[model samples]
Target: MSDFSAEETDLMDKHEHILSRRAELLERMEAGRQPPTSHRKQQEKEAEAARHRNESLLQDLQKIEERLKGRRLPAPSLLAMETRYWASLEESIPAWEHFLLGKGPHPADSRGRSPPQRAERRASTAQDRGLPPLPKHRPAR
Candidate 1:
């Protein structure tokens, strides 16, 4: 029993040490200082390890949350969250795409229509003239 207690205390101490070190790393990362080569390598390794740890922690958290709620989240609930996320994305797509891809606006049609076809349609449409297009094509007599 004494040996077990000593081992448990050692484990707790190690955990506390790790937590403090992680905090220091986070502070230094935020400071944006130019670290020494070895320090930069160590920080990169620590960040990679922390990312993996966080991913597993997130999965555990989600499982615990589901269990505590006493019911599974419905598919619709997940879908609604996804839809809300995408709705928020609608406003920023153009800016985000421009920043990420360094390209101009997306091509209007995925079907590979010629630019002339798009232009001609735009000219022929009544909506382009600020009035509704006539329903049928007819020649003026």
Candidate 2:
């Protein structure tokens, strides 16, 4: 009461009074009827339906949690997590970097495609891949 302004406190008091009177009227009306009115019964039915819906939702949540128990992965390694974090940061940096630095009609455009393999790498392609060349076929007379 001390926290509320006088006008707000008055409004709150009136609201409480109205609610109490409404409850008393409902009780009196029920006492006069053979059975509660259809409107009251409808309200009660809707409340029960809401409770049933909440229970169904809770059951579904529990089932989903149980299903995930077997599927969830073990705790991730810190090293793998850190590598993914850095990779994602670098991944975004390059997406717009070319435009930011100005692209096209730039000096350094003349370039030639380098050979597929460097001289040192070309000689050991087979050994590096763990596969040697097959024997060549010879013609028979």
Candidate 3:
């Protein structure tokens, strides 16, 4: 037989209740958890995915390489095309320079003014007519 006072029995009961509550809380916390995957299994999955991506990329690369090989241009024809392109570019330079210097009017614009001058004239005309200046672009908030 054990000798205990009423207060000691009550304190022991409280201690047991606290311990049981702690254990219950711990169990509940772990109940919704999943077990961790093994490292080897996780690594194997990653390696398999990488290999699949590599194989797919390799296949695409091979197809592109084959297509390019089939479409290879003859060196002589390629050189001739490049030569013609450069020659045309060089021929246009003198006209471009003349236009830039404002020595001659552009054949496209009969007003003999460049595009920027035309825009400025339009804006001035609008202002003279008491119309609102064209809305300047504002960035969206």
Candidate 4:
């Protein structure tokens, strides 16, 4: 048995084998013995196949990267939390406060809030002026 460790022996063997192969390849190049033939169609086919495989791998990597990015998000943003808080407040507005905001004894709609008192006043005023009632909601410009 050699004094060298198993890893060292394996590495040395691999190095020698690589060097031997390199030398043989170099010698063959120098001799120019039976110069290798070029198969253009076969090479093109192999290149196309390799490109397709690379594209497929790239798509898979992109999908995994996007999934990782999605997971990397820590939590709901401050703006989102604040928005939810305000929405809750809007929904929970008391019937008394809803009436106070308007002049008339406004009844709550299906969403539990009456239409703004200004819309009713506008429609009545428009009728008094002998004009068509203005739309409750404005059209986008």
- Name the best candidate (by TM-score): 2
Q: What is the TM-score of each candidate against the true structure?
A: 0.24, 0.34, 0.32, 0.26
Q: Which stretches of candidate 2 lie over 4 Å from their true place?
A: 1-36, 72-141
Query: What TM-score does structure 2 among the candidates reach?
Result: 0.34
Q: Tell me how far the alpha carbon of residue 18 in candidate 4 is from the true structure, in angstroms, after superposition.
A: 41
Order of candidate numbers by TM-score, starting with the best? 2, 3, 4, 1
The lDDT of model 1 is 0.83
Tens digits of lDDT, candidate 2, 1-141 = 665788898899999999999999998988888655897899999999999999999999999999998695656697789889999878766545654587532222223323444544675876688887667899998
For 24-127, candidate 4 gives per-residue lDDT tens digits of 99998876854445666678889999999999999999999999988854467977898899988787666547677874364455345556765787778889
Using lDDT as the measure, the top candidate is 3
> Where does model 1 exceed 4 Å of error?
1-34, 71-141
Model 3, which residues run further than 4 Å from truth? 1-39, 72-78, 84-141
> Which residue pairs collide, candidate 3?
none
Cα deviation of 29 in candidate 3 (Å)? Answer: 23
Could you tell me how far off, in angstroms, the CA of residue 133 lies in candidate 3 after the best superposition? 25
Candidate 3 lDDT by residue in tens digits, 1-141: 245677789899999999999999998888647445676689889999999999999999999999999995779989999999999989877777778898866634644667888889888888999997667899999
RMSD of each: 24.9, 19.3, 13.9, 22.3
The C-alpha lDDT values of all candidates are: 0.83, 0.76, 0.84, 0.78
Candidate 4's error at 70, in angstroms? 0.7
Minimum summed lDDT over a 10-residue window in model 2 is located at 104-113
